[model samples]
Target: MSSAVSNQARPAEAGPARQPVPGPASTGTGTSGAGASGPGPGGRGPATDYSGYPLVGSKHPWRWVGTAAVALGVAAVAWSLATNPRWEWGVVAQWFTAQSVVNGLLETLKLTAISGILGFVLGFILALMRLSASPLLVSVSWTFSWIFRSTPLLVQMLLWYNLGYLYEKISLGIPFTDVRFFEVQTTTLISQFAAAVLGLTLNQAAYSAEIIRGGILSVDQGQLEAAAALGIPAWRRSTRIVLPQAMRAILPTAFNEIIGLVKGTSIVYVLAYSELFYTVQVIYNRTQQVLPLLLVATLWYVVITSVLSVFQYYIERHYSKGAVRTLPLTPLQKARKFFATHAVAPSRARSPR
Candidate 1:
């Protein structure tokens, strides 16, 4: 009882219990010293002997099946194209770069360039008008878009071509006076080219206005307000802050519209203008090689659209800088990655021991 009482009464030893004297192993100091962890040399975990096991890749059976099916379909289409005699591929090759066709192509390009530039410029102004505080500007913008967009493009082209029936003369003169600065007969003034340009430009403007307005609206109002609060001038704020952000939203749709316009130039054929489609029609009508001539036009259109698509991709990539951490890979980059991964893997697997 006294021993127990003395043991209990004694003050506890200070700090921790006495530790074992550290040897080479515990101190990890000597060349041959091994730690208590029993790990590989240099404290790494044991080296796994993966060479003994064969790797089994994850199964994607459905994916393989889908790929096989698509390959077969593509092969069938290619075979059909090869064997079909009605395609008259020789005629297509012959006339593809003929002088007449080239001239028509130039005309088509001219129309597209002029109409696209004028349409977008007018549309930008109309978009501003639509978004303005004044009721008159908004109403005028709305009415113009409504009338143009609601009517068929074909009708507009016809109406513009036939404007002479409604007005004997077109003039720039005083509102209610005989004095005139310029005057021309309506029939002469609204020739085929002039009428086609007028119709396409107006129609394009109507759609472009909406596209621009939507893009502008997509920009956050808070940013604009913040810019204003920070005393950034309205013009600077619009050009610098709003436009840059809004373009990201606008570009994809805008490119689609432009592409559509390229095809839409076909409608100008009704006016008997010498655009690509009209030229093709004339050739086919004369030679009776309808399919081949049409094929030539189709190929040219495909080439144009493909080029535009490339431009669209690069432009979008440029604008995506702030939106994405990494820019999306280009087709060339993707191809390189694909080959590197698959080709390297197969070669590595077949490598000698």
Candidate 2:
């Protein structure tokens, strides 16, 4: 009886048992307070905070400083050039559009066009020969490329100009038939312009052959096999399939060569062919305005090269089909888009009532 009374007394003395309250189930609503309608603490909800995962706020102060420094340097140089009287800006303007200069410009363009066409055509044939199965053809192509490329273009030009010294006559006829169809004095056959074209074309063709070969090699061997499997004729396979693809690789370097050829036309000054550079020399010799004349030539070259570069950009874009998902915007398009995006005025925030 006493033990039972003691147990009852112990129960009466002890406090009430506390029961655990169940937390709310996550609703992915990023709230976890009373009704789960607001952020819980530290402005973050019960859901794990990943807002700071990709950490920001890293700064590189030197980049801005360097950019500003470069801009200032360029501006300074430009200003100095503009103000310097030694440049003889007046003389540059005077002869910039002279008739002789214009004629020289035309001649330069002519040489570039003819040389580029002939060189590329011959180069294409040489490339084909290099890729041919016949040992004799390969050897001949290799030897031609080797000889032309190894010799200085200036030397070649000189040699062609003086061809009369080596061979008085050039003949075209059936070999060993004593039936000459045509014969001409070497000097008469090769005028200064003709010699320049021959030299430029031969030199350009040698380098262009290597470039073409490289482009052809860049195409996958599997592509050739596939074309062959389809029973495509060799010519058709090369021209239709392989060459089209190879052009993507070829165009950039080929354009570079063309531009070089444009500049290379200047070397014909040695033969006294009156291209742009030669024209400049003639004017400078008369006027003794060396700096201005040189500047004129430099500016013309820059303009021509710039135009070619622009053309190259468009051609490259044309050939980049299927290679890139989206074409890049033109400068005009980019400028228009930039102004459209940035020219708008921002809305002003209203004060709270």
lDDT of each: 0.84, 0.84
lDDT of 2: 0.84
Write the residue-wise lDDT of candidate 1 on 69-127 in tens digits.
99999999999998899888899999999999989888888888888888888998899
| Most TM-score-accurate candidate | 2
Residue-pair clash count for candidate 2: 0
Residue ranges of candidate 1 with Cα displaced over 4 Å: 1-57, 333-353
Candidate 2 per-residue C-alpha lDDT over 229-343 given as tens digits, one digit per residue, 9 for 90 to 100: 9999988989988887888899999999999999999999999999999999998999899999999998999999999999999888887787789999988889998667656
- Kindly give the number of clashing pairs for every candidate: 0, 0
Where does candidate 1 have its weakest 10-residue lDDT segment?
Answer: 12-21
- Tell me the deviation in Å of residue 304 in model 1: 0.5
